[model samples]
Target: MSATPAPNASQSDAFAQLLRGSLLPTAVVGLGCVVVGLFSSPKAAWSAAVGAVIVLFFFSLTLLVMKRTADLAPTTTMMVVMATYTVKVLVLGVAMFALRDVSWASGYAIGVSITVCAVVWLFFEMRAYKRLRIFAYDPDGAASLETPAPKHDAAPTDREPRDEP
Candidate 1:
């Protein structure tokens, strides 16, 4: 009944790996959006860059919190992630709303592009999480948790009594 030790991040491509791997893709996506923005509207490109920064900041914060509190309850973890996501979206939405009178089409495009990049990053992270499944426990008492029950070849207790004439 012994449990295997969790894999080390160093031994596997994990959270850090995903973040590192995403850098090039993120930059490529951002550059493409900027180029598109310049052609579509330079103002939109600038707005998209700002939106991307906000989104990345919020996403990184969520990851940091999750990494720190991996042992916490699932509800608590989801709440933190959801709360941060809501804040980020709200802030971005408010910014776009405030600039509604301006070239909103570009702004919206930029915002959506940044969001797409964030979603891409999230997909990689989720993949890594599925593979990692990191967990923490008291190493000392860990053995106790895995202790097996004593084995016995005892007969069934509920067996009916044999009748003798």
Candidate 2:
């Protein structure tokens, strides 16, 4: 069987829109945090930048991975997601442990920036998802992700009805 193309940020697909919405706000807030952190101290600035980058990378990777796995079996998707989560947690733990004694990074700045950026990203993503017309359960059938949805005004079908019947 031929494989479908993986979803990307370049597409006008639902996940792509959500990805854009999430990334934009996270980036803006991340920058703001960095600027504010700079005003506080160099250490704080570095911490804030690191935190923002962490949040952006993790969230984007999750979304993109999910998009890539959209066509996979549910069990396979779950396994992939679990593996991803485990790896992320382990990486984060190791990084934090390695950086615990860094003289130029403030934990407070990092924590605050991570929280703010994650919140902003999640909020915008939720908003974008809410605005999409994706139907989870259609009585007719499920819609295809690789193709545009059928337009209502395209043409009349036999199902219209018999006037005398």
Candidate 3:
């Protein structure tokens, strides 16, 4: 069979962004925790990975919800993200606490990795937002419906009033 064609520049860029956004941070924290534990307490290192797996599972579920509900209001999306993060942190904390005698450095490593992932995700999101805003602001672009600004009062301003006062 013929060799497959290499991916285009944009595709490669997207893949790179995905790797930075999703994988690197998680791997960082996971590997860090495991290594730290390997020296201090091998058992805890293994246990921390299992715990991180559960947290990652929850993260995947949260991302799915966000993707499926993108058309929802900003407030709604914020609520979902916050709720998911809170739940994940609580569960992870409890699990780690349960293994109190274990080395705590593993937990630190896991936290660092997740933080790295979050930073990557935030960076990509900001980039996407910038692109969308730039496209929407293009002068030659097609006209589109504008969301009306909220009114502070119900007074009618359709016609000018007489200056009889």
Candidate 4:
């Protein structure tokens, strides 16, 4: 079977808008971590920066996958989402284990920065979704009440009445 088409421009635009909304909070969290880490050590600052980058990378990847799969069937979209999440989590776990013992890496700084930035990103993303008016569900099948119904008087019938015998 032929593959499904990609999402339209508007869907892509909405994803982009979400990314934009998340950016400022993510950056602020990253910068705050870096500044906090600075007082500890250069390595701590670097670790926080690495954590920020990792979070940003994963978040962007998730959004990219979501955008790419938006036009597909719901099941296909769900599969993609699960697959991406699985891979992202596995990779992050491996990276954390590998970097756990590195002398220059500050685990505490990385952990704290990642945690805070992730929470911030999630909050902003939720807010963006709440503010967006992309979809509305109407269970009753009533036409949207936003627009006024057209005015139409009953039309006269084009037939004459028969006389009774």
Candidate 5:
């Protein structure tokens, strides 16, 4: 069978920008955790992988929500975010209860791995978000978010009158 390559995504896209910033660091930590776990025991290795997968999947969902709401009003976006979080929390609680007795994925290893992945992911995601262009002044906006301001003296007429006689 012949192998065909998948379509390429642009790095300039919002989703891609956040994905690169967050996924790289999370994946690195996950890989390291899994590698360390492998040396400890087979069960540890699988647990680490499982834990990492759970956190990564949840994070990806958050990013997807952001992308979908990028053009929405700030209030709307926050509402969507809160809704998504509530759903995830409910799902996680049920999943945790279901996995309470599972021995294949040790609780300790899973907890440690999940904790590390989550912290690393949050740190990287914060960094990435800070780097995103969000110019609030210009009508065109985000296009100039990272662009340097034009060098020019402010026009006197640009200022509004403070008082009238």
Candidate 6:
């Protein structure tokens, strides 16, 4: 099968910009969680860090999928997006369950950190999307509907007289 064409520079740049926008807020929240956890316990601190890492991991995975699918057909892209989200959610759930009773991890701290970081990332992403200037339809790029289709040598002439019953 032929590979999908690579995304244009602008499309790539938009994804990069989205990542950049989300990164700072998420990092700040993660750092704050770490600081708060530090005062609570070492386990808490570690859990907070793990939560941050998890959020970042999922975010990166999403970005990677989006980049790879950027040039694909819309239906294919949507399928990719849905599949990725489903996998990400399942993995996250499994990880959380497995780590729930771990001795060195504070469940409360991890939960809080994950929640905060996820929220921060989502808001940043939403804002970035809102600020993006890309248009769904570009008038300048559209072909004129009035343009005549090219005639092929083998095609039957439209002007040929036809007998009407």
Query: All candidates: CA RMSD in angstroms?
Result: 9.0, 11.6, 8.7, 12.1, 9.1, 8.4
TM-score of each prediction: 0.58, 0.68, 0.49, 0.76, 0.68, 0.77
Candidate 3 yields a Cα-based lDDT of: 0.58
Q: Give the per-residue lDDT digits (tens) of candidate 2, residues 1-165.
A: 997775543333877888988998899999999999989898888898998999889888877787788678899989898888777667655655666567778877877887788789879989988888666776465454447766898776779666994
Ranking by TM-score: 6, 4, 5, 2, 1, 3
Model 3: CA > 4 A from native: 1-20, 101-165
Which ranges in model 5 have alpha carbons more than 4 Å from their true place?
A: 1-12, 89-100, 133-165
What C-alpha lDDT do the candidate models reach, one value each? 0.66, 0.80, 0.58, 0.85, 0.79, 0.86
RMSD of 3: 8.7
Please write out the lDDT profile of model 6 over residues 97-136, one tens digit for every residue.
7777888898888888887888899899889877887777
Candidate 4 lDDT, 1-165, residue by residue in tens: 997665496788789989988977898889999999999999999999998888889988899999989889999999999999899878766766677678989988887878788889889998988777755787565766677877788887998998989
Clash number by candidate, in order: 0, 0, 1, 0, 0, 0
The sequence of per-residue lDDT tens digits that candidate 3 reaches over residues 1-165 is 897755444444443454345554565666665676577576656655665565556655655666544557889978887887788778656755655454544554454434444454446545644544434374864454566789989876888878996
Model 6 stretches astray by more than 4 angstroms: 1-7, 139-165
lDDT-superior candidate, 3 or 5: 5
Tell me how far the alpha carbon of residue 37 in candidate 5 is from the true structure, in angstroms, after superposition: 1.0
